[model samples]
Target: MTVKTFKQGVFLPHYKKYSEDQPITTIDLPNEVVIPLHQHIGAPCQALVRAGDRVKTGQKIGESAAFVSAAIHASVDGTVTAVEPRPYFTGTNVESVVIEVDPEQKEPVWPEQDLSSLDKDAIKAAIKEAGIVGMGGAAFPTHVKLSASKPIDAVIINACECEPFLTCDHRLLIEATAALVEGARLIRKVVDAPRVYFGVETNKADGIAALKQAIKDDETMEVVMLDVKYPQGSEKQLIKAVMDREVPPGKLPLDVGAIVQNVSTAIAIYEACRYKKPLYERVLTLSGDAAARPGNIRVRVGTPIGHIIEQCGGFKGASGEEARLNKLVGKIIMGGPMTGWAQSRLDIPIVKGTSGILIFSPAMVAKTEHRACVRCGRCVEHCPMFLYPSHIGMYAENGRYDSAVEWGAMDCFECGICVYVCPSNRPIVKFVRETKRHVAAARAAKAK
Candidate 1:
């Protein structure tokens, strides 16, 4: 069978071998956790617990009245040590709730809700209370997705963990197949979608099989095999591949009467509605050449990257020994190499959207200086958004931020294909970032 796929996405090397087959292992609770209040895409949460307050596991510690935000919960029974600004993965300081875990832990109990009797409003309320967001890195509130304005007929469960070197979703599919399938059904019920499409890349044969077997004999859902391509798991591409629907530019999936969701988010929704569990922890990939031990890890929301590395046996060459993955280290990216942010340090805590951490040796880092863009159309040819990346990038680099937007810089999804194939090693994604920042700043100034 020919798998469906979106056009123009690059077929780069799939680097998921390190942890793709490794079963997930749980990390021990860290001594302290620094959970940010602004983990999602919308308004930041306000501190609900003050310093010196004792909190239980799954307790809400940060909350916002804003409809676009989700609550923050304590992952462990602990004492609030501080509610102060701390370093975040995106290179900004965010107000965070720092907790000191209690030496003795207790099994936590949550208020229960009957899933069969809950209405759509009640279900949405439960999702919001669970603090669930798009665990696939977008971090948008899940309840908002369920509250789509359009009447959706199809809901896509994006199991296409398309980013290179990230395989936590694959592990989830193999290990928790039933949970994921049931979760998809729960999601469909919430949105009243007629059918659910579980989209998986053809590369994940095991995941595809597991999902197929799990959804067998079920008429509400079907397993869709997608092509092997980078960014195929992206919401826009996933929708196109599974439903043959093109979301018009400047629109969303709801515009096409469809809603795309990360497989992890569905599982979280299931846990919340069934067991009344809050999303204080998540499963993420801890792979790459840099770590001494690379595997999938189930980590709490506020655990620091430094502790994660220590549990994984530290960086490739921590003991003054030259390990293969760490000869002249160049950059430590916090997510996948293609779209992840370069981390200045490892003190940042894991957030809901963190999918994987990557370490690149100097050999892998681009050493060539950013040069003038040649008229080559590689960026345009490879762009998934069909925008002139080079033109918008040049406009941004030249400080013509408005012109960059005029050239469709806003349309760029920062997939890094332009930067990947550029012969001159131009930082097209960086320009896109800058262009967006400037455009936002301009909007704010005008509003003020």
Candidate 2:
């Protein structure tokens, strides 16, 4: 039982006691759902159904002919009210399919298929057709990983769930252990990989035990226990921790002869291949200091955050006098606190990459004005990628985008460790994001 980990990652509080042990509950369908045209990293999908068109559950409503893009499906049987711009979690408006949920809805039945006879192409086709993506929040299309040009020897299933307060992956491991392992194997077959590794953190002892027992008889599968560290589940860091491989900058895990997939992503792959089911719904954690009820829930893809929050009992102190004035909740984040977006409004709907909805009380949130960098050098010491975040932030702060890139600003994964450890409370991740946006815009202009 050797413990493995990469270097230079911060050790933060787990904060998972609230919902780590809770079983995933299926949430009731909302009155309306908003499915964004682009939920993944690649090209956006075009709407296949217009306003007033009726769509059934699991129906493909949006798709792109691009090889890197994943299709978008309807999560419920309903009529499309609009195919237009709507608010997203990222604080930007995106073209989305708005559907009014049918009152008398029937569950879509997916007849299970015999998975034994499916070949590599068939399995990949199933994954693409199901519109599965990296469910750990990246939302990178899974089929693109399977179509790797480089030879892959090891497939690392990231079960770390290292983000504080998000326990959806931990609950999945403990509850759906067999399905996760089978899904990992299916991914391996698609890539022609020889072995599979489940990289799990030590904090989730129950999940580790469940996975170990499930893979006991399989020689090709093994569970690697990782140290409890922030960003341990990140692709490059996970590869380094599990197989001692380093993915070079500007490259992918496949470059180092490995493929990394999140625990929930693997489970989605299994569901798609075995049951011919699409990824219309997913499990996510709803927890934080301001949440009235903290638990893991299986919700449809297009459900609005406002509806989900109300269904879960609303924010804490909801019935109190302060709640009436909306003074109880200070912040509502769409994912893990460290790396998630700070949502301004609750109307934003959950997409495929959503992993959690965190609500924080005003007392829990630190309202401080960011000051100048004090040059303490804590961000560099704690950054998992070992980049000079202070220098990058300083350069980007002064609109020096070239200098920021020279300092490896593009390599930073926006893990938020810099912001967490900075004494000045500088928003280094935000600065890095601004630098990236400027850089991308410049590149696009140059191309023109």
Tell me the TM-score of each prediction against the true structure.
0.97, 0.98
Q: Give the whole-model CA lDDT for all candidates, comma-separated.
A: 0.87, 0.92
46-150 per-residue lDDT for model 2 (tens digits)? 999999999999999999999999999999999999999999888888999999999888888888888889999999999999999999888999999889988
Candidate with best TM-score:
2
Off by over 4 Å in 1: 110-113, 320-328
Q: What is the C-alpha local distance difference test score of candidate 1?
A: 0.87
lDDT of 1 by residue, 1-448 (tens): 8699999989978889989989989978899999999999898999999999999989999899999999999988999999999999988899999999999989777666677887777778889999999999889999888888779999899999998889999999999898888788778888889999999999899998888888789888898899989889998888888898999889999999898888889899888987889999999888776667889999999999878877888777763234433454567777788899988676889999999877666776778798898888998899999999989988888899889999888888899998998998889999999988888888999999
lDDT of 1 at 183: 80
TM match of model 2 to true structure: 0.98
Model 1 residue 246 lDDT?
Answer: 92
- Which residue pairs collide, candidate 2? none
